[model samples]
Target: MPGKLTITRKISYDTFVQVMEKKGAPDSLAENIIAQRKYTLSKLDRRFVKELLFGSLRWYAKLYWILQKTSNRDLDKVTAQIKTALILGSYQIFYMSKVPDRSAVNESVEYIRYAGQANAVKFVNGILRTISRRAEYFPKPDKNKHPSQYLALQYAHPKWLVDRWSKRFNFERLKIILNANNQQAPNTIRVNSQKVPAHDLLNFKQSILREDKNTVYNKSLATCLVLKDSPNLEIGSQFAEGKYTIQDGSSQLVGHLVQPKEGEYIIDACVGPGGKSGHIVELSKGKAKVTAVDFSLAQINKAKTNLLRLGHDKIEFVCQDFLDFTPTQKPDKILLDAPCSGLGVLRKHPEGKWLKSPRIVHNMARRQQALLKHSLQILKDGGEIIYSVCSFEEEETIKQKEWLEREYKDAVSFPELSTRLPENYKYLLTKENILLILPGNKYSMDGFGAFIIRKNESVSNCRQAK
Candidate 1:
C-alpha cells in the first residue's frame, strides 16, 4: 500500500513548487523557504529535501521530455502544481535508483492531493507509473538530424547552450562536459591559514576522517580539501571556528593568482559574497589592505557577516558600483571576477541551464568589458590585474582578453604567470598565458578562465593590436 505524504517529502514538494512559481535560483530560494519551516527537520530529511528539489531542477528538461513521451496531455497546459509533481516524481523514478519507483509515484500522487489538487492524483500517478515502465526505453530526438535537440534532452541542458557548445568542441569533448555537469559537485573547501594551517588540519586526521569519510587534502593546493560525497556544511565545528570555508578549487586559484603580500593594497572590483576577498586576507595573514566592493548592499552585508565569522573584520567593505568606486590610493592589484553566463558551474547550480540564455551571456560580457576597462584606471603603475570568470565562453574570456590587448598598449601578460603556479598546475596555462580550466578537467574543478596583465609605467593606447 502507498503511504501518505511524509513531512519531508511535503516540504520538498512545497519548496519545488515555490521555486517554479517564483522562477528564482533553486539553491538560494530553497534555503530561505526551508529555513522558514516551524519544525526542525532531521539530517536525513534535510538531505532528502535538497536532493529531491535540486535533482528535479537539475534534470528538468529530460524529465519533461520523458513526461511528454509518456503522457497524452501537454505538460505546459497542465496546472503548475500537477506539472511540478510529475517532474519531481519522474526525477526520482529515472535518476534516483535508490528511491523505489512505487514510492516515487505514490508520493507524487499524495502531494497533488496534499496541494488541494485531488483531481491530479490519478493523472500524476498514471503518468509516473507509465514512466517507470518505460524508463529504460524513452524516446529521444535523432542524434544525426537533430543533434542539438538530442544532446539537450539527453543531457538536460538548454538547446541553445548545447548548440553553442557544439560548435566549439568535438563530439567526444562536448559529451564529456555534459556528463560532468550532470555529476555531483564535490564539497571543496579552502582551509583558513589564520586559524589552522591546512597541514595542521590534516594532522587531526583521525578526527577529520571520522567526521567525513570521503575527505581528502589536495596535494597541489595545500589549503584545499575535497569532500567528495558530503552535503553542504553549516553545523561543523571546524567551519564554525573559522578553520575553513567552502569554496571551489578553481575559485581558490584566483586568490593564488592575486598573490597578496603584506603592506600591498588589493581591490576586488565585483566581490560577490567576498570569497576571494576573505582568501586574500587569509593569504596575506591580515597584512594586506583590501577593499571589497559590490553594487548590492545585500551582498555587501552578507560578505561582511561571512568574513566576520572567519575572524577577518579589518578588511574594508564598500557597497558601490565598481565602475564608480575609487579608493584613497590606487590599488597594487585588482581582481575582476566578472559576472558571466556561469556556464562552468552547472554542476553546482543546475538551474542556470534553464534560467540563462545566450543573450544574457552577451550582456554579461559587455558588463565585463566595462569592469575590465575601469579596473585599470584604479590600479597602480606596474601593478597587475587578475581577470577571471566562472565561464569559458569565447566572448567573455578570450575575446575580452583580445579587446584589452588591442585597446591598451601598456597591458601585457604577467611575466611570472607560469612560475607562480604549482608545478602540477602549470599545465592550466594556455598559449596566451591565460589560466583556462575547462569543465571536466581531472581536478574536478569548475570551469574557470583567468589571466593576469601588468601595467607599464606609462600607459599607452593602441588602435590595432588585434
Candidate 2:
C-alpha cells in the first residue's frame, strides 16, 4: 500500500500569508508562527521562515513601490495572495542576497499558480525578472528633490514616520536615531538584590560586563549585565532560584529613582507584570511593604506568578485601576510607570513605528495626565512619586511634566535627584531637574524619561491636620 503519489509536503506559503494577515502586527505574527512551529520544525527551517516573514513585512512599502513601478499596475487592485507572493519574492531578491534570483522568482510563480492565479503567474514572473535585470532603474526621488523619499528608502521606514521625525529632530541626528531603531536590542537583566547581591551576579560566569562607556546600563546600577543577545535567562536554574529578573536597563533604573528603603511602605501604581515591583522588593531586602496595583486582571495574574517565582511574598498584588483604586494605607513612596505609546522603545519594537499614529500619542497623553493626578492623591506627605514612561514623545514626557507643575503647583516639587545619578549623567537632567533619556544619546540608554516628584511636607501636614 504505497502512499498515493504524495507530491507536496512542506509547510504551505498560504499558511504563512494567512498568519500575517490575521496578526496584522509583524513582530507578533513572527513570534506566533515561531511558537507554533517550535516543536515541529528544524532550527534551520525556522530561521528561514523567520527571515521570509520579517523581511517581507520590513520592506513591504519599498517592495510594493517597486512592484507598482515594474508592473505598471495599481497595487491597490492586486489580490491579497498575489500581493503577498510578490512581496515575499521581491524581499528575497532585494534583501536576501544569498537566495538565488531564479529560485525566488520560480517559487513565487509556483505559489501564485497554486492559489489558482495561473494567468497572473506570467505577470509575476515577468515583473520579477525585469526587476532582477534592472534593479537600479526603479524610480527613486533624489535626496535634494524629495527628502522624505530619500529617508524612506534609505532607512526602510514609512514615509510618514520619516517626515514626522525630520521635523522633530535635526536631519543628521534623525539618521542616527533611525539606524539605532533598526538594530537588535541587547538583553538587560536586573539582579534581585534581596536574594542575591548584585556584585555576586556580575561575578557569575554566564555574563560579561558591557565595557561600552556610553551605556547607562554600565553606569547606573551597582551591577548591570547586558547579554550579547536575547536568551532564555528565565528557564535557567539560577533564575528559578530567584537570582535575578530579566528587565531592560532603563526600566530597572526606575526602581532606583523611587529609592525605597528598608521597612518603608511603597505603592507601585500600574504595576502590571511586576518587573519594577519585584526589583523594588528585592532592593528593599523584603522589608518594604509594597502594594502592587494594576487595572488589568490578566497582567495582575502574570505579576502574581512573577512575584511568587522571585520568592517575594511580602508584597501585595491588587487588581484595581489606579485611576479609581484607593489605598488602605498611605504610601511612603509611589511609582507610576504610566501607560505610554512607547515611541522611545522603537529599537525594541520596530513594528510599533507602523502600527501607531499621532492621534494615539495625543490620546495617551490625556490618560497619563489623569493617572498622575490620581497617583498624587494617595502619596503620604513627604513621599516621593517616580513618574516614568518608556517613550520619547514630548507630549508624553515633557508635556506631562509641565501639566504636573501647573496643576499641582506648590504641592508637588521636582526633586534634584540628578546629584544621585552617576557623574556622566548630569547632563541629562533639565533645568527643572527632570530626567530625559533620549534614544541615541551619549548614554545609549533605552529611551526613558522619569521625573521624581516629592509631595510637599507642609501640604501633607495641612491635609492630615484637617
The numbered model that scores best in TM-score is: 1
Model 1 TM: 0.94
lDDT per residue (tens digit) for residues 317-427 in model 1:
888988899789989999889888899898988877877777988899888888877777777888889999999888888888888777785555455678677777889
lDDT of 2: 0.72
Question: How do all models score by TM-score?
Answer: 0.94, 0.82
Model 1, 346: alpha-carbon shift in Å? Answer: 0.6
Off by over 4 Å in 2: 1-57, 97-134, 206-220, 233-241, 457-466
Candidate 1: worst-modelled 10 consecutive residues by lDDT: 457-466
Pairs that collide in candidate 1 are: none
Worst 10 residues of 2 by lDDT: 1-10
Q: What is the lDDT of residue 217 in candidate 2?
A: 35
